[model samples]
Target: MGDEWRAGGFGLYIHWPFCEAKCPYCDFNSHVRDAIDEPRWRAAL
Candidate 1:
């Protein structure tokens, strides 16, 4: 088990919660938006 994660087992994720449309099978916490506050969102990230 030692150093197991070093073998390409880790990932980096950035969750942007806004989308133009919602897909039927996506299990993400997201929203459908016609517009977004981009500057505010960038600052939050």
Candidate 2:
């Protein structure tokens, strides 16, 4: 046996996809004046 293996690692990325109601200092991949339905977004996750 070589180097021991540790537990599996996992990551979760959540995108807001909306920023039209706030300031304009954000540099992320956000959108503006876009309608986001919750049920439709849940299906995407």
Candidate 3:
């Protein structure tokens, strides 16, 4: 169990294609795209 954190390390990741409002509690990376293609986005990921 201890090896997992040691080997992989600790971190956080968030993926947001569109963020209309700002969140008070959260201080993470985010982006707001005016237009997004759902199919293309999924395929690229």
Per-candidate TM equals: 0.69, 0.46, 0.37
Give me the runs in candidate 1 sitting further than 4 Å from their true place: 1-9
Q: Write the per-residue lDDT of candidate 2 for residues 1-45, one digit (tens) a residue.
A: 233333335445787777666556766777676666869878988
Task: Indicate which candidate wins on TM-score.
Answer: 1
State model 1's lDDT: 0.89
lDDT of each: 0.89, 0.66, 0.66
* Model 3 C-alpha lDDT per residue in residues 1-45, reported as the tens digit of each score: 466677778666547555665677767675656676768867877
What does candidate 1's lDDT look like per residue over 1-45, in tens digits?
Answer: 567669977677999989889989989999998889989989988
Q: Could you tell me how far off, in angstroms, the CA of residue 13 lies in candidate 1 after the best superposition?
A: 0.4
Best-matching candidate per lDDT: 1
For model 2, give the 10-residue run with minimal summed lDDT: 1-10
